[model samples]
Target: MPSLFSWLRRLYSLDTLDTRFTSSASASAQTAADTRPPAAKDARANSIAQGARAPLWRTPEFFVYYLFFITMVPLMFKTVVDASNENNPVYAKYSHLLSPGWVPGRLMDNSDAQYASFHDNIPYLVALLVAHPLLRRVYNLFSNRSAQSSTSSAAAAFDAQLEQRMQFDFGFGLVFLTAIHGLSALKILFIFNINYRIAKNLPRSYVPIATWVFNICTLFANELCHGYPLEPIAMALSPGSGTPGDQGTLLVQWARTLDGFGGLMPRWEVLFKVTLLRLISFNMDYYWSLDYPSASPIKKKQLDPAALSERDRVKIPAEPAAFNMRNYVAYLLYSPLYLAGPIVTFNDYVSQQRYTPLSITRTRTILYGIRFFLTLLCMELILHYIYAVAISKSSPDWSIFTPGQLSMLAFFNLHIIWLKLLIPWRFFRLWALVDGIDPPENMVRCMSNNYSAFAFWRGWHRSFNRWIVRYIYVPLGGGGGGHRPANGKPTGSPPPSSGLGAKLQKICNFLLVFTFVALWHDIDLRLLMWGWLVTLFVLPEVLATMAFPAKRWSSRPTAYRVLCGVGSVGNILMMMVANLVGFALGLDGLNDLLASLTGSYLGLAYLISCCVVLFVGVQVMFEIREGELRAGINLKC
Candidate 1:
């Protein structure tokens, strides 16, 4: 109907609309195509990350081994129980009459009481076992969620962060395994009197030889689960062969050649020997396995060039990677302090490639020497006295003392031992607090804090505590940098950096730290009760700290000086009471006495005495505080 020019214009407008639609659709399609590669690549990276993070035993091998061991545990327990019963005819004859209705004869008499104890402890064991797998799944889910919400860089950073934790977890697994094994053995020896000599002469000829072979095989299977070699040669060449004196030494050296190599040959050989030596040393020293090295997921990796320019870059020193065998040997031989120690980090140890005195000074070398002498003196004199007067005397049917007297003595002895230990700790703290020490900065900071007054308490006893923290806390989701709301606050409570937040944070920190402090002593009902009571008493001081921050007081001369003195006295009393309570609970007779004493007028008197002591404690704190204040004022004037 239109002229030719108008027709051409109409055609152009329609074409423009069509072109716009086509271009928009093409753009959308192209965007989707471009995004697909990253999504796929991200997924691939995640899979790789997960693969790297996965525990060593992914297949059913660990399960199969666990089941096999579980079955054998019962059998081994039975053997020991029977053996114990046979040895103790007195118990064997009368135990039936004394048996409570709840305990079956088989359950009471079973050689595998320790192993079966785990069976009875099914709830706890199951909880621990299930917790790890469940936590892993939960972690994975959270990781995925975080990745989805975050940029690729953030996601990558998270993965790397998790990787460091994984390394700690892996290392701690070795410690945990060692603890379980050592503790089990110790329990058997202490409770059932299972003689180690029995193992040495376990077989009585051909049949015994077969039994030994079977036991050896079982041991091999157990070691295999832990990624250790079960080769007989490895055992023979291990340091401090269970045999006594020079005969054992010669045998160890001779067995070294069985590997058809020298003592320091094959890397696996060294690892195996070291593992053996560590185990042997743990047994010899009656110390826990806090130093064992295990396979780690956080292998050394090249840093990305892009991340180098970041402001928060942690510049770790460039140190040699080789182990200082000389220092390692020295640490083993002379330093009983490391029997429970600084829990030397691999990084710290490797940094000192030479035996230089400066390196030693940096490592608080002077303190090490002081600790050695002090520890030896305490072990010889103080511990010996406690052992003779308390532990030995407190045993059943003591000729020199009544059970009550012995119990009281035992309680006081524990206090003495704690005091003795404190002396060395004070020295260690002084060394740590002094400037320019090469010890970890965190260790120094922890030493400086008044709350951590107990030497064997968490940060101060770095070796054992670090092992426990790594093995237990991190895996349990408590230790990692994952934010825990400030103390006394609810789990999901808003952080307390704001005005209201500070109070909540303080409360949470107090409760959490105290609870941890209590649990760290041991896993027993008595320990828990003791911990709870101590926390109640200690909470006020912690709250005070929160309410009046140390820094704030430091600025106010009069207040600061007074607070310092009070703090010192308060901390000492709190520690002493905590130690005494812990000691009383540990004593078999003392626990009974306390339980019996709880319902009388005398009990009321005892309670009053405790309260009065606590009051005097306050006075002591005031005096100390006032003294510090006077000193500060004089200095200022």
Candidate 2:
């Protein structure tokens, strides 16, 4: 097999992969350029010879893990939001399940259960995934025995053949999922207490069985239930919603009309949802793979037997997927991210699992642990503490705060939203990192120091953005880095940025992407509006930066430093204000915002004045720094 570098070169371009890994490189350079991180040089060398190892506890994660394991954490932390919990009828019934114990559950009534229906199932999934080491030991006993058998080589070859044959066919995928998940589905359906809660707190001995089944009937397999999933099915069964190609009514007609494409609108729910895109990506990337199964092969009955081509008789196959069922299942069902995901591509995941076994090091562990801790601090201190205080004071009364104050509220609120994502998302990403998968981090560095619209969206829920680019943007002829102009650009497409057509194409692509984001988030008008607001912001920001670009401050470090500090604050202001328009408005808040827009326009002027004051204040403060020149000296100079 080729080295990882060679494989990446084949998947993407030589430009995307480091030039050091080029085929023309000398043998020694090639060897050295094949760097796999989170692994020691020696450990990497022995990875093929040995097996995968376990992750260890480190800084921040260690603290959480230790507390969860040792302390009476269940009893220590309880947030009683409603008085109903004190007198709740279900509380007495499920009290034992929620008792302070290992993997404790929560007692929730009908009033508060909606929020947790999905979130709560994750802990059960996590427990099973955490028990993966135990499962591996059992599998190893058999694998070790197979290694000693004379027929092992032949068996491996057969398995390789099987992997190659199981291409992108929905029938095969459906059958695979059905076979794997059938038993667990029965358990979930038939057995009492074997529901989500019982699944989480299931007896340790029975966990491996249930978990294996869960992992096996995989989400990655069935290809998003063909005509999309749940929502579409409902729409199709509804009285007036026409079939996909046929728009039944005004709502359906308008939906199909939105993107100038019929499918994206009428079955808008299918296109507008978030999780569905991940499934769409899995299908697209799987089929896009080299030597994969072609679209549902023409049936034998549909073909004239005499004229049946060679392609009909023997199906073409993609390169062998190289996925053992065990590892494939593990990637699909890895618990920490099973609920809150930065979904890893199967190819990246399998490569990490098979070729790059992560060596746990003190430095790596501590670094990951510290990040986890920082995320915790941001979540607790900024979101829980600050947001709670802010939310309590916020109301519909327009006179409560000036425009400047509302803008400030928007800034803090956007940060709170990003921080909220960090809680579960960071935990999921950190778990995968410790295991050595390098599953793309969700929030990336956006929350830390993002300054531009491009940087902000790219950093937030980053994996999904990648999925969109790979499966949607590039496929739709949007060209940029890693994408060639000819990939899908039409014959009459604009030649360059100097042309009007080129600018229009850029705008079109921008709007389409954000529109998709709107749909993905929800079919809500506010979200679509939000998407457009962001699109407008990013496009101009990109153009403005490109047009009258800032001076390259490499020669003047102080000036550049000041520019950066100012830019950070500006970014927050723009980000928050846009979010306020698109998302952060309620009934009273909406009235207040409208009042600012319509009445007197004084609030708007106040907002502009406050921003000016803020910028000038920063400039003055920087100029007057004790180590540098003071403001008084600057007036003379």
Root-mean-square deviation of every model: 29.2, 17.7
Please name the candidate that would achieve the greatest lDDT relative to the true structure: 2
- Candidate 1 matches the true fold with a TM-score of 0.35
lDDT of 2: 0.43
The TM-score of predicted model 2 comes to: 0.52
Which has the greatest TM-score? Answer: 2
lDDT of 2 by residue, 1-637 (tens): 5697764443342211222112111222223233342122223334422432222234463355455435422221221122113243323333332322122232322111212232355475356445543444454455556554443575354443333222212223233333334323222123212223223356534543454343223322232443233334445655667656755665544433432322211232222133333334333333334223334222323543222222222121122444333333344344444445776665544333433322224344445556566655544433222222233233434454445444444445555566656656666665555444445556644342455677677667777876666655654556642233113323223345565555666677778888877755545677887888777776656665555345665467556646655664576566665676665563346557557644657866765655554454334333323211111111111
Per-model CA lDDT versus the true structure: 0.35, 0.43
| All candidates: TM-score | 0.35, 0.52
Stretches > 4 Å off in candidate 2: 1-129, 141-275, 291-318, 321-334, 357-363, 382-384, 387-395, 401-408, 434-436, 446-448, 480-501, 550-571, 586-637
